[model samples]
Target: MDDSVRALRAQYGGTLPGPVEALPAPHRRDLAAVLDQARSRQQRELQESTDASLAALPKPLRALIRKALGL
Candidate 1:
């Protein structure tokens, strides 16, 4: 993450990025909405991967999971 930040700063000719809080209300809201959508998509992908892994397990292991989950 630090390397990515450094790369971003270098890409922008060493200028520091402004804080998100410094933006106007509308801009901040837009940024928040985009971030929320991105987070939701990422969470969905992670959940799907977990579900796929669980489905691939043997029945007894899967039953233990369902019992633990109260499903």
Candidate 2:
């Protein structure tokens, strides 16, 4: 693991918040796919919110939100 990740583990008293590796590989892949879908949905929602505020926000702030959402 990278130093930063190791340091983070140590920061949390050398234990993970959850049993990260307890799940089998197939279950892990399914979990990753679900997380990806949720993240995509979140990005879409953020974009819709920014779109609804197009005229209310300054051009810079709207652009910043779009960039932050990776949209």
Candidate 3:
């Protein structure tokens, strides 16, 4: 694997699901960009999901939890 792929696998606990190294240089760059975007979207979705779930709680309790968690 290339250093980039190895680094990604290490950072993400080996869950990255494709062979990024075998592509041509331009395609590799495009794929890397796509992967970066996917990671960003996944993070945003997770944060939104957490916020939505927390919103289901009582307001006062949610406020307290948020304060305690420094959210």
Candidate 4:
């Protein structure tokens, strides 16, 4: 396996379920790019959801909650 595959497997606790090395170089790069974009989108969605939830709270409670959560 290549270093990228090995790194991902290690990061995922050896539970990566496919032959990552079998992919052609171009396909691998495309897949990596797509996965990166998906990760970014998911993070943004999570942050937006958190912001919306926090905005629904009263200002004083929100400030206290934000302080307690270190946000």
As for lDDT, the candidate ahead, 2 or 3, is 3
Per-residue accuracy of model 4 over 1-71 as CA lDDT, tens digit each: 56566545544566565666577656666666677677789999988998999999998899888888888
Best by TM-score: 4
- Across 1-71, the per-residue lDDT of candidate 3 in tens digits comes to 56566655555676565565555556655566677789889999989998998999998899888888788
lDDT of 4 at 37: 79
In terms of lDDT, the poorest run of 10 residues in model 3 is: 1-10
**By TM-score: ranked, best first:** 4, 3, 1, 2
- Candidate 4: where is the Cα deviation over 4 Å? 1-18
How far in Å is the alpha carbon of 62 misplaced in model 4? 1.0
lDDT of 2 at 61: 86
Per-residue error (Å), model 1, residue 41: 0.8
Winner of 1 and 2 under lDDT: 1
Give the higher-lDDT candidate: 2 or 4: 4
Clashes of 3: 0
Error of 3 at 3 (Å): 12
What is the lDDT of every predicted structure here? Answer: 0.66, 0.62, 0.73, 0.72
Residue 29, model 3, lDDT: 55
